[model samples]
Target: MPCHLILSKLADKCPSAVLAVLDSLVEPPQKTVNFKPKQDAVKQEVDHNEDMIRSALRAIASLNRISGGDCNLKFKSLMSEISKSPMLWDKYYSIRNE
Candidate 1:
């Protein structure tokens, strides 16, 4: 059977389960009001994030060149708290499942 037909049948059989799954699939809206951040703070943060990303990219590229293969991601500890936080974990799982 087609996937939508199967899902409809299952949802008909278990409306609550289907609703729960769908609710989980929906993303929460960003709470940042006036997302255009005020000049200095936003600029600083953007610059910092950009620098970190570039540093990581450089490290990965160098490793790949030296080893002739993809390098392992080595900073799980650095992001563990953020990824495991309640707010972020929910969004992370929702995005991954999608």
Candidate 2:
């Protein structure tokens, strides 16, 4: 009946499908740790993976606050990965709650 319930059921039969759908919803950012688009965009060195982890954490925290459900997310790194998809990123960025 609800989206969360639907997502839970979908997660049981197809994990990737659930992930893909979620990714399309939450969306992801492109900037890495150094606040640059690509390797060449920044002059200084940056730990891309570490930055991704941080950003994902922040994103999840925001989601939890907005959703008002203490989601207690276990794997934040996944959000970083989802944010990479162009379709997902664009859709999420464009969406407005109000």
Measured against the true structure, the TM-scores of the candidates, in listed sequence, are: 0.29, 0.27
Alpha carbon lDDT of each predicted model: 0.37, 0.42
Residue runs of model 1 more than 4 Å from their true location after superposition: 1-41, 68-98
Q: Model 1, 28-86: lDDT tens per residue?
A: 11112102344667777776644443333333222223321222232232235335567
**Most lDDT-accurate candidate:** 2
Per-candidate total of colliding backbone pairs: 0, 1
lDDT of 2: 0.42
Model 2 clash tally, residue pairs? 1
User: Residue 18 CA error for candidate 1 (Å)?
Assistant: 46
